[model samples]
Target: MAKTTRFATLIILMALACGCAKRSLVALVPDPDGKSGSISVSNEAGSVAISTPYRATTIESAKQQPTAPENIGKKTLDRMFAEALSIQPARPLHFLLYFENNTTLTSDSVQLLPGIMAAIKERNSTDISIIGHTDTVGSKEYNSELSSNRASTVKKLLIEQGAEADAIRTTSHGKENLLIPTGDNVNEPRNRRVEVVVR
Candidate 1:
């Protein structure tokens, strides 16, 4: 029985070692909107394409180059994939800040300021999205205005914390999309929030 178990483990280890020896193709393309893209890979006679909004696929597998009238060779494809990997940029990071009832001041939200600023500085973020949302406690118009104000407030704070003003874009969803859906005139604490996307 012990010999059988040892033999099975050896087979598994050999399989894993062989898998690691295979070559994989990876391509990083920027989306048309500059916010998303996709990656594709083929291994062991199978192929797959992965769609990504702000991140790159991390995988290691053998790749099959597409056949065309030009008849691109595997050597060329391998070189292209190598170059892409060498120059691929880092992926963007996301952060969320929840606001207090009818106010942009939340203890937890305030505490995130330093970390957000540090990430921006460390990653050298150039583009950022500051979107604000609110609960369904007031008229649509009023909520819209309040959400915009909240987003603006966060943007200001980010700038003061060393973020570039020109790189920040602020938008207000108002009460249109609630984190915790509720009926009209309802005050959902979780609904009042701001989302920050740093790229």
Candidate 2:
């Protein structure tokens, strides 16, 4: 009876040891994502390159979705003005001023003059970037010259309104950077405009 009891006890201990060893072995296998464990198991099967589907949206894809112009317009100009205000005039702010095509600045352009002047006065310094652009009505050279003259005119007006003359820098991009791209002969009223960047 003593021999039989001893044998039974040995069997029980062996079973318990096997169970513990099995549990430990199971634990050693890492989780697929490796949230735990020192060793990471890649889900890839072989050396062959696997192309996974991209899940994130790209900027171009986002742009492909139609959006209201008003929403963007409200955001851009106001944001630009706010950014401009933050900049010092000693570091001139750049601005883009649009004008109607084939039309010279009349009272309408003058109407914005006060606001422009106020903006400059608020800065209390001069340095400015004045760029002019035009529609595709005339030869490129002529258009360039015309745009330059228009910018110069604006510069002169700003000087008259208390802005320092030497502080202004001007350029003309004539028939380039059109606000609206139309046919070669097509004239866009919005394209014939001057852009002032105060940087």
Candidate 3:
């Protein structure tokens, strides 16, 4: 049998036994949050794109062509990658803090800050992404600025709580990305928010 090794977000196969030979595999797996991601694997034979979990390509050797994509069972993966899985880093953490009509966080969202801080501090290593989003009630420029301000507000609070300033990244997606899609000029409380992902 072969074992798994981390390659970016994909899992790569490696020999795990004394007699395991040249065969190797590359599989795409979903994140712990159940969100799917994509990856591509190639060799001298050709290349294949894998976006679905469990889908993989088998490579016979460095010079030989890879086999067509196929499904690999979860049992097979667990057996092969036992050692690697044991040492993998904790999966990322996610939080969504909603805002009201303006950039100010809602009362409920403000209450979530302490829990968020605790999660970040519990990690051995942490990298944070704060993405701001706003409702489609204003001009594109205005909405963009509002989103950015939302993200900055969250970042400022995290920093004040002792989170490393350099470890946090902020982005604004204005009306482009929305939690609740609505027609123009709609006021959606859920659409106005900041999403923080800690990994």
Q: Considering every candidate listed, which one attains the maximal TM-score?
A: 3
Clashing pairs in 1: 24-61
Candidate 3 local lDDT, 58-152, one digit each (tens): 77678776666667656667776799989998878899999988868899999999888998888843589999999899899999999999999
Candidate 2 structure lDDT: 0.58
Task: Write down the TM-score of every candidate.
Answer: 0.61, 0.51, 0.69
Clash total of candidate 3:
1
* Pairs clashing within candidate 3: 45-65
Worst 10 residues of 3 by lDDT: 1-10
- In TM-score terms, candidate 3 sits at 0.69
Model 1 lDDT per residue over 127-179, tens place: 89999999999899999999999999999998888889998999999999888
Q: Name model 2 segments beyond 4 Å from true.
A: 1-103
lDDT by residue for model 2 over 1-199, one digit each (tens)?
A: 4543444354346546655332110012223354333322122331112122111111112223221111112232234347754653354455555565543674566688777777777876556778888888878888888898889888888889888889888888888778889766667777878876554
